[model samples]
Target: MRAGVRNLLNIRTRRVSLAPPGLPRAFDGFSILLLSDMHLGSIPELGPAVVRVIEGLRADVCVFAGDFRLYAHQSGPTFETDLRRIVDAVRAPAGLYGVLGNHDTIDDARLADCLGIRMLVNEAVSIRRDGATIRLAGVDDPHTYRLDDLDRALAGAPKGAFTVLAAHTSEIAADAAHKGVGLYLCGHTHGGQICLPGGVPLLVSTRSPRAYACGEWDLRGMKGYTSAGVGASIVPARFNCPGEVVTIEMRAKSSRTRPARTSCP
Candidate 1:
């Protein structure tokens, strides 16, 4: 790890938050905590820290967006213990949902099942509350080997349900938008793992444009957030773009009024 980056991790993960806009009325007061790109294999403080953050956030639903592990090679052992410990912290009003990132391995299946985490690897599930239904689908990270078929990921979803898709890369937002998805959540860029002045990511993964590097994005009618993530890679430290715990409250957008706060265009 870079000496400077190590020092930042010692300061604790940073909290970057925003409310998801364009939501329909069903989730008016719901809160969903998003954890993505958690490169737990490299960062030591992250696992324990994720545990602490989840307990504190107390969100109604916690979504482990992707990248629970960083190295496919060591994932069998390190993630066997550490990653599960980190992900186990997540809690939702009903249950936690997860997807696999490029770095994740087959071993993640054990942990995902052990923790009762809903594994969304090319699958869809329905969540219901207040006599309303929300359809959520999770797709494996496409950057590694699998071909990303948006149509396949959403094959069985019902129409007019609050459809949310979780993939590892923010680029999937476009596909979600095209498919009329109400919400999309993902994180694979690590928010560039480094930030320049004015919160600009100096570097980013291949999944998206730099503008959508670390926060909320408005894509036509689709709305979502890409967390800066709670872990690291290449180096085990974050500079200006510190680790993140993002709190997302799902509000039902009203036709009568514009959202109280819209994301930066």
Candidate 2:
């Protein structure tokens, strides 16, 4: 138990590179810092620990996949205070964006906006560089809330441009890929908060396939990554699964990459 407790302070950085077809060359090597599931109210020390990890890391953009607090109804002032501290520590040059999770409320979305993190609520945003563009479409929580509208989020997006979908869980992967999403970013499973040896999760509380529970996965031709998360949920201790702050590098893949298949989960 002592080792498990100490594991909370052992947050690590996981770096991954993604090369998706149709990605804009101008956006090649585009770095995105992905953060999720920081249930600050569950563990008091998590807030500062997360801040310390992300203080100097640089990225082209930053995004938060939700669960600002432990419970969905928790709206204390300190939750806001700690969230602000974490948000202020981010170092993304393009901007910071976020999406709400099952354990979040509309109020949390509003608070994220106040803190300079653009909350994407069933909408999309574009990051253009050197005349090339990539779209970031995000939807509401689909796990428990069931408010996600993938079609609405991708309404105005161009068909040929690369699109990255920000969802709270991999449960929405099927729909996002059907709508031509190039990459999907999410975090809710916490990589199975308590895993067996070899990082095998004992329980991955998600409706999607187990493969999408923790790390990079491919749905058809779409590239996806589900963060193990930065803070623990339910319990503050982790076994084989340590908390993580992920940095993803997106590059342009060769045009000859296979076309997206019709299968999905």
Candidate 3:
């Protein structure tokens, strides 16, 4: 199949719901749309398709896991145009937030501002609803940039508040669990982008456990999802692994059924 046809045919949405321990009542049923590894400049034609998919989804908050642009030093005119189109099309009541990926440049912050999306670089922000709050923390790229700092990201979070972290790669899973992070959202491996039959990844480009190559998993004590992502990289084609946009519904764990705390690696 043609690259565009393959991408169009494979782009799909994955919905997941979780009720992790200690979730606040206010955040119960909170829904989030997770988008990652856009790699916009790589395949410019896919931009509108991605925007269309996002526009059709409904969620309280939208989180972009990263790779807004393809090359580290590519010109911004095209990237800015395509990114603005995609960002403008999204609607989220809670807000739109994102972090940078290895292929993105520092100047992409200006693009983020243009799109009205908050770019978090090793920082945390609190979103309130009905007088209750949840903390959203984000770190820099952990792959090519190697600039992630989990401590710095979670330093400003309120004590005992439910915290969700966004990073470019699942490599931070262990560290995030150690810090008591409740949910971790990331995408970089693309589930190998192109995989063998039965969805066996021929290669997963991260230090995270093999199981975390894609989909949801319990990393130590933290709940996490590594998205297959919406765009391709290295090559603009995907085989068995389709591109994805993830929807995560967060429900509060039942108080009576809360499990005892266990040590995390």
**Top candidate by TM-score:** 2
Give residue 258's lDDT in candidate 2 (0 to 100).
28
* Local accuracy of candidate 3 as per-residue lDDT tens digits, 190-228: 778777766778888888888777887887778888888
Model 2, position 243, has a per-residue lDDT of 86
lDDT of 3 at 73: 73
Inter-residue clash pairs, candidate 1: 23-253, 24-252, 60-93
**Sorted on lDDT, highest at the top, how do the candidates line up?**
2, 3, 1
Residue-level lDDT tens digits of model 1 in 1-265: 4664563354333333333444556667676777887777575555666677666656777778777877776643455566667555666667788888887875675577677778888888887877788878888777775655778778877766677788878777777888878778887787777666455677787656765666777788677777777777776766666667676767665524334542211
CA RMSD per model (angstroms): 3.3, 4.0, 4.3
Q: Is candidate 1 or candidate 2 better by TM-score?
A: 2
Error of 2 at 65 (Å): 0.8
Q: Which of the two, 1 or 3, has more lDDT?
A: 3
Which 10 residues in a row give candidate 1 its minimum summed lDDT? 256-265
Clash count, predicted structure 3? 0
C-alpha-based local distance difference test score of model 1:
0.69
- TM-score for candidate 1, please give it: 0.86
Candidate 2 structure lDDT: 0.84
Candidate 3 local distance difference test against the native: 0.81
Q: Model 1 off-target regions past 4 Å?
A: 1-24, 75-78, 255-265
- The TM-score between candidate 2 and the true structure equals 0.93
